[model samples]
Target: MEHPALHQAMLKSTFYPGEAGPVEFHETHISRLYLTHDHVYKLKKPVNFQFLDFTTLEKRHFYCNEELRLNQRLCSDTYLDVLEIRQDGDSFHLGAGSGEIIDYLLRMKRLPEGRMLSNLLTAADPTLPGEMERLGRHLAYWHRTQPPVGGDENADLERTRRNWDENLRQSAPLVENLLTADAQNRMREEVEHFLTEQAPLLRKRQSTGQVIDGHGDLHAEHICLTDPIRIYDCIEFNERFRLADRLADLAFLLMDLDYRGRRDLSAGVLQAYDETWGTDLDAPRLLRFYKSYRAWVRGKVLGFLAQDPEADAATRTDALARGRRYFSLALGYLCRRPSLILTCGLMGTGKSVLAAELATALGAIHLRSDELRKELAGLSPSSRDLSAFGEGLYHREATERTYRALADRAELHLAAGRTVIVDASFAEKGRRDDFRDLARRQQRPLAILWLNCPDELLLERLRQRRGDASDGRPELLAAQKRIFQPPCGESRVLPVDTRDEVAYNVQRIICHLANPEFLKEQP
Candidate 1:
């Protein structure tokens, strides 16, 4: 159906009434994008794929409304509303009209293209770090508030597994045509190994309620770093594609960073995420696996384009090269695992100082519970009321909630293949047990460094502390001392004296983490 009436309705719509000229319509493979000077309107293409359905006019209109509704959760200001295209005799008009409806479009306020993170990164702006870190905080906030999709864990895992398997199977034929026999065989073996190794972890993630409907496509191109750092163009067509393991969502950024040759920036983003969320044992492995998966998916997509009969020879060759590059990047992350070390102690114990140094030394994820707690509470660490020790701020219940939140975040990070340094008091036996269990479950090495000092020294340090990220007050320290449950017989604790120089204390923790067995009790 040509639907000229729908096109006329869209063009004459009052959605951008004050704009200077006629609205320009741009069509992508999947959607029709109408751009005015002040707004951008998108309508789903009337096409049905195995993964996406927008075959009928009604379906397209429903999804257009769905996009508007879902996107408003994050970018309420930008995603204005869905406008209706109404047919009047031979022509159509937008808005609530008394005529035959033909189509719908999700209207959004236009943003400056220059504000995109991808563009800023390309321009080599130094402010990119602060911008990305802010984005990390925004993402962390969104993840915390987003409702979980309730479903059978086994079914979800199987569904995800089948999707991944299908991607690999689809790409296998192309790989055969593109590579030498030896290379093809090697790639097949690697894919098989990856599937087998990651299957159980994927299951664990779903069963533990870690799978959620996340921004399906998270990459530099999709993220616009405007004032509020708007993340637009989320996958709205397919639930299966969008509902995913959280680690998979994070992997997009990691892969994008690597693709851009900014591993340092990637590291910083992960660190900021860890600080806001929590530490994880499987982070390094998960990062590698997800990065590989994202790269493979990209490679598979490029391979499809390469095989298109309409593609020019140059375009086909370029697509093939892109596929090969991503494939290599995936293999590189899979080849090695990084080491992780956790710093555990009470407030004013120099744990943060030590953790920061260790992170610099080992390029680890420096996760702090204080930062995460602040994030969860929807307050900054510097917020005066954060340490009030009352309802919703600081108390037994609040602390428990914070620790659980940290544990959840830690697990996600661990799954992404990053070494993590968890900076927390570990003041409770139960809390310590949780970390130990996480390490054991993930099959990753775990070490705990207990910073200790004389009461006088600790008191002095606490008193001298200026504006800090932690919520520990002198009064809270007194309470902590009273209730603190130190690591016991079963706990693996590496004790470090805080009275020593900062560098010396950090070095001691690093040495112990390098070889945890050295810190074990001598028989």
Candidate 2:
């Protein structure tokens, strides 16, 4: 059944087991969760893929029960039951015994949000390392309880190879369009090299019977740092994903810790897992391989999310931001070389937001033209100048000065071997050309993210914009659109639509940076 309307109608607190209050809603590609004060009601989206299918009501119901069964092993008190969501004409009711059942909900008791492990990472708790150790031991003890999947190393190796091949096959469409095409080649090369060179190690781990029914998706967000840690949300829809070498499972969490820039905590987690699992073997290279594999899986998922048609603009953009970060993060464990980026588009297309997020991900500095223009004019960032498109403070000479200053600052940083992202409306080819020349002279790869959006949404955004440095308005859109250069036939330019069905904007920059040929070499 189509779930969008159902999702909207079920937002009222009447359907939940809580007192009347607002229901918090969240969505992933596979599921939609309704969080009340006491419990979270998770509804599976009807999605059919090669891995699993939840499109039919029977399948969703079975999987909902399967989820309760699998997760009960860890958090028995948390996974309450798989409840029927029945529909009577227009209204929907939770746990209804009558009426036509439309879908099933996995009912789970709410965990403390503040105590979630992801949130606690920033609290600077003195005992966090100890907590990580405790968490690791708990996972290891659980892994031991699970029946081993046996030690047929050849079959297991074949499965691993199959999974990797399927991932590449599924992700081929995203290459070069949403992700860096070169990353696909680089990632495959690395994995194949590991599989060939480390065949003995892979066989040994398999021979030791390390494979088990374990949590397939184990990241910080799924963990709680309570008195006894609670890890929920096991991948129940697919057995292949859930059954793996316990070390592969461990690799998921370790990779997450490393992604969080906490190798110390990763060490702690690994140490405890080793101590509890009765194995002193510490295979760093194997662990690193698994970590990269895990990162690629996550990055590939995010890239799919970047193309999801149902998600909103902000969600899509955020997916792009994370996809780029994750792919680049997995491409090399080392820091990337210096690069340059420019956010060039008309006003009200979300250039600043994308630029800022890109800056945070790439560890680059963001230079906004609007802010810099004001600074150059000796005015505060919020100072208003209601000038026409090409007059007053925004006149030709003034804009040239602002762009020149931006280029100079970017060049200075580039000379110091740092990455730079400049956020601006490059309406003129001459202005963009100046920056291209600067990047060429510096020999740093440069990309221009040209953001676009639906005209109606753009107009509405321009109209509603307030209390910001941007002077974009509905009135100025006609002028901006009429005069804006489209950056046609430019190898360094990537155009993006900002709303739902956006063209995966920021991730393309990562793709460009991953391949040197994507940059313009001409002076």
**Cα lDDT tens digits for candidate 1, 92-164:** 5667868877777788998888998889889998998787688777787777677666777565566666766
Q: Give the TM-score of candidate 2.
A: 0.63
- Candidate No. with top lDDT: 2
Tens digit of per-residue lDDT, candidate 2, span 58-176: 99999999999999988898999888888887777777677899889898889998889888887756788989989989998998898878747765676777788887777778776
What C-alpha lDDT, on a 0 to 100 scale, does residue 186 get in candidate 2? 59
Q: Give the C-alpha lDDT of model 1.
A: 0.71
Which residues of candidate 2, in runs, are more than 4 Å off?
3-9, 17-20, 89-91, 122-126, 177-179, 280-282, 333-523
Error of 1 at 475 (Å): 80
Off by over 4 Å in 1: 4-16, 22-25, 176-188, 198-200, 311-317, 337-523
- Per-residue error for 308 in candidate 1, Å, reads 2.8
What is the TM-score of each predicted model, taking all chains together? Answer: 0.61, 0.63
Model 2: per-residue Cα lDDT at residue 515:
52
